[model samples]
Target: MATIFQKCKAKGDPCRRSRCGHSWTVRYREPGGRSGSQREKNFPTKREAQDYGIKAENDKREGKYLDPSAGKILVRDYAREWLSRRSIKETTRKNYKNFFENHLIPRLGSKMLCNVMSSDIEKMCQGMCEAGLSRRTVYQSNMVPLRSLFRSAVAEKRISESPVALASLPRLKTKRVDDKSLPGGEAVGAIASAMRGDLAVSVWLMAGCGLRIGEVLALRDTDIVEGAMRLRRQFVRVKRDGVWKAELSPLKAREEGEWRDVPVPSLVEHALRHHLRNHGVGADGYILHAHHGGHVLDSNYRTEFRSAVIKAGFAGESWTAHTLRHFFASSAIAGGLSLLEVSRWLGHATIQITADIYGHLTPDAGARMRSVMDGVLATTNVSRDDS
Candidate 1:
């Protein structure tokens, strides 16, 4: 039984109990809140009791301390919360969710949010690379999400610092070069030859006017007036419950940037009139559908374009649906249109994208410029000779 005592001395102090065998004494309060008696303990030596008392006091302090529960939170729980707080479009959110579900959670869900160290994350990334995932994918899987999680943890006071601060990962490289443009004349011919339904007319607009796939699909019959096609909305496919389907959403262009009017070529206008006359518009009055009814999903056009490419023998090399847009831009540059004009036609937010993709055409433009300069020089020399 433990005793509560006060004014006691440990053994080996000069004060000794001559008659009793007890070697040491202690001064302590009783365990209860009441007044207590002083007590002394027998010790083989003074050092023993002194050491025991010091250890007991240390243990008491430790027992009274409370550690935080922040380290106990799991990585998976915080990840879900983080995703919910992000302000991204529905399609973008779906993509992030897929990456988290398929790649992130399965690997690191069991980790404690606060206790996840940099070494653990680095090992996970190395493992992913060894497993044949690309460097870009590994960064997406481990680096991006871990950084976001640790940042949140710091904000919530769950972690003191992000462990991945010094980590390095590979940068994403562009998958392929951007030179797959076809000639505009060939594009028009392909559209004319491929006419079987209203789809053929939409193909003509896309190839001739350089419209995006989404923009082309979202057109309404009423959008065309006086031989001009109006661009307003863009259709995008989003994943819902693991299935991807088209949704006719508003244009993703910036504010006050929804619509553009493109003049239709004579042949394209004839085709459009033919499609509208024979098929008639749908209840929604979209122009580029079977019998001019129902909205055409972008996927439908991609499939038809690929089929057309194969039929026209353009499939052997690098022609794709997007080749038509590139073809339009390249042709415009080749036809003496300024980069600024081409940029506006393509609805680019900036002219740099237009110049980067089509800047190679400047060489052709420069050749013609040099010819005109030489001709002017020759005329000046001939006038001087006549004088």
Candidate 2:
């Protein structure tokens, strides 16, 4: 229950005994408070205070009560606290920190968490778009953290609900036509040839073995078996003591000590041998290492990749390093590998994810199935005499 009253400020002076402000205060028992503790808020008018009291009681009964005082914290403060408490992967945590500090906090940091509304979220997204961020980036990378933050705030009772759930974000645009096409062998060869001899093997590993950039960067000779390579770790940039450094982390979407064995095709094996004979390995045994020491930094690798792309006459194209992974997937599908086989080879969390991304590559699947059925039926020899 809530009670509204005018404060009796009579302890100061005789003149103040009969004089009081027009403000009214609503005193109410706090929801989920220990020992039946009370909280209060001042209103400019009696009706407003009465309305607030009624709403507070109703909200408490409905289990939607939000402490007004708790919501006063700024977004920047709460986001830092939220980030510190998150139990996500180190790579993902680093990425989230980048997004929060550079994007989310810059836009919404000064605003109070409770005062933020759905419009603010929409506006923030619009601003990102206007500032040259792609629609996919704004929708996926940017919104994910914001949505998670507000959702956490709601769960923690800092806000009544998440504004992100109410905001109207547009659907992401479909993949561009160019994104559907993977590089041919010639293009791959050209790009690799344009790269320095020591770094050329990365192109082959990614294109021939479906290895991710991080996985390739972290590969070692010890992990290579008789016919396959074990993927157990990756090199990713992580922030430690306010400085960024490349660190080895567990494989994505897999538990610690869990590893997958991907077959090293002849092309990849030959390239790996050539790289080893020429450049040797780092102190940590990483195949790809810096000229001075340590594993190759991700930024330096991408920069070299871009330079190679330009030198190979692939400038102004959408051929990012991940494009090699797509080429590998397409080649595997074309070579009659089942979706499940390709999914496992590509280290996907699920076969459906592989199918969703590369399903179109199997356009001749129905024809091949028909041909197999025809062959099986032809061998059956269904003569009338046999019947």
Predicted candidate 1 versus true structure: per-residue lDDT over 1-387, tens digit per residue: 333222233335543544444455433333332454433444555577676555444534554211235657788788888889986567656767776776667777788877778777677778778888878777754465567767877767676667667555555543332444354576557644764565677667767788888887777778878877778777789766887778866555443346776777687778778878887776677776644456776776777777776666566656666777777777777678898887887888788767766876754656878998998887464545555
What RMSD does model 1 have?
13.9
Candidate number achieving the greatest TM-score relative to the actual structure:
2
Q: Model 1 compared with the native: what TM-score?
A: 0.59
Candidate 2 achieves a global lDDT of 0.86
In candidate 1, position 79 carries an lDDT of 83
- Assess every candidate by TM-score: 0.59, 0.70
Taking every candidate in turn, the Cα RMSD to the unseen true structure, in Å, is 13.9, 7.3
Candidate 2 residue-wise lDDT, 78-174, digit = tens: 9999999987788788788898898888999999999999999999999988999988899977777788999999988998889999999997644
